[model samples]
Target: MKCISWNVNGIRAVLKKDFVEILYALDADIFCIQETKAQPDQIEVDCELYPYQYINSAQKKGYSGTMIFCKEEPLSIRYGMNMEEHDTEGRVITLEYPEYYVVTVYTPNSGDGLKRLDYRMEWDKAFSAYLKSLDKPVMACGDFNVANEEIDIKNPKTNHKNAGFTDEERNSFKENLLAYFVDTYRSLYPEKVEYSWWSYRFKAREKNAGWRIDYWLVSPELKDKIVDAKILTDIYGSDHCPVQLDIEV
Candidate 1:
């Protein structure tokens, strides 16, 4: 199956920028998006290509949210981490298939000056624990918000202490992998230095100064099933590009 995950930044905005055109070009079996910033009722998406749709929008209007469009109907769908503190943000959505689970998340950013670092750490631990508790093969993808290693981000030396590259956040990511998941992209291309999200300032995308903050992490057991992992840097609707995973389901 071909699964693609992207942080569209804002669904309503992307719709005006040939989002549907890009969607048709990719033709993925499942399309997962983060940072939707709109409730389903508030917007209209002609996602007729995909019969099944699931959305989790934040309680606050025009905020963090996630949506999943799939050709395959899942056996069940779940929202959030089953924790009130985490669920309120509408950051997570899980779809259970007969073979595995597909989860999309919009992980909270640490914010400028690392203001929310503490909360981010708490979220990482809780979210990772929740994934582990699934006890089934999982494909978790979204804007993870943390660059796992130096190679995953440009200007790593200067950005080490930055929100997304902080030591605390990186370690939380590592700890999660140590438990039950594998960063599918890194597993396939350990030395690659590509990125998924780029800053909109200073011509970052033009200069190719970006960070591979988005990811497709699969349970260890699904590692061998991975056929390809990719970062679609060419597609442009949002500052964040899409990441894809092709696995034998």
Candidate 2:
């Protein structure tokens, strides 16, 4: 199956762009989206291909949210980590199939001056535990927010202390998620440099100064089934481009 994940930044805004067209062109079996920034009632995706659509919207209007569009119906669907504090943001959505569970998350960013770093660390721990509790293997994807290694970001030296590239976040990501999951893109292309997210400031995209924050992480057991993993840098609509994972589940 071909699964694609993208942080659209804002669903309503991206809809005005070429979101529908791009969505059709990609033609993924399961398309996961993050940072929807809209309520369930406000999200109207005009695509007919995906009959089974699920959205997890935040309690607060126009904030962090996630959505999944699937061509095939899942056996079950779950929203959030089931933790009250973490569930409020609509950051996580899990779709359980016969073979495996697919989860998409919009991990909270450490705000200016790392104000939310403590909360982010707590979230990482809780979210990792949630994944471990799943009965089957998992294919988790979305804007993870943290750049795992120096090669994952363009200016690692300058960004080491920044939100996504901070030492604390990186170590937590490695210990929590990477301990059990395989980062498909990095696993396949260790030396190839590419990025999925670019800062809107300073013509970052134009200059190709970006970070590979978005990812498709699968359980270690599913690593061999990975056909291909790609960062669709050509696609435009959001600050973060879509990351694709073609795997046999």
Candidate 3:
């Protein structure tokens, strides 16, 4: 199966770009999008090709949101972890299939000056627990908001204390992986320098000054079925590019 994840930044905005064209070009079996920033009624997404569509939009208008579209209908779909604090942001969605569960998340970003770092830490712990409690093997994807390792960021030295690169955020990501998930991209290309996200400022994308913050993490057992995990940097509509995963499932 071909599964792809992209943080479109804003669904309505990307729709004005080549979002639909890219969707047709990729022709993925499943597509997960984050930072939609709109409710279903607010945007007209003509993804009739993908019969199954699930959306989790934040209560706040034009804020964080996510959605998943799959050609194959799932057995069940869940909007959030059933936790009040986290559900309000419309950050997570889980679809259960016969073989495995597909989850897409839009992790909260620690605000400027790391103002929300403490809350972000709490969120990490809760999110991990939620994933661990899943009944089946999982294929999780989206913008996790953390650059994980030094190699993930363009200038680790300068970004050490930043919201997404703080030591605390990185360690939380590590703990999540240690729990049972595998970073598919790193597993396939250990030393690859490709990135999924870039700053909109200072021509970061042109300079290739980006961070591999978006990911497709799967249960350790599914690692063997992963044929390819790649960052599709060439495609553009948002500041973030898409990440693709080819698996036997």
Candidate 3, number of clashes? 0
* Best candidate according to lDDT: 2
- Predicted candidate 1, C-alpha RMSD: 0.9
Cα lDDT computed for each candidate against the true fold: 0.92, 0.96, 0.92
lDDT of 2 by residue, 1-249 (tens): 999999999999999998999889999999999999999889999898899999999999999999999999999999998899899999999999999999999999998999999999999999999999999999999999999999999999999889999999999999999999999999999999999999999999999999999999999999999999999999999999999999987
Candidate 3: where is the Cα deviation over 4 Å? none
Candidate 2 local distance difference test against the native:
0.96
Candidate 3 C-alpha error for residue 52, in Å: 1.4
Candidate 2 global TM-score: 0.99
Q: How many residue pairs clash in all the candidates, one count each?
A: 0, 0, 0
Best first by lDDT, ranked: 2, 1, 3
Q: In candidate 3, what are the lDDT values of residues 1-249, reduced to their tens digit?
A: 999999999999999998888888999999999999998898677866687788999999999999998999999999999999889989999999998999999999998999999999999899899999998999999999999888898999999888899999999889865457999999988888888899999999999999999999999989999999989999999999999999998
**Clash count, candidate 1:** 0
TM of each candidate vs. truth: 0.98, 0.99, 0.98
Between prediction 2 and prediction 3, the one with superior lDDT is 2
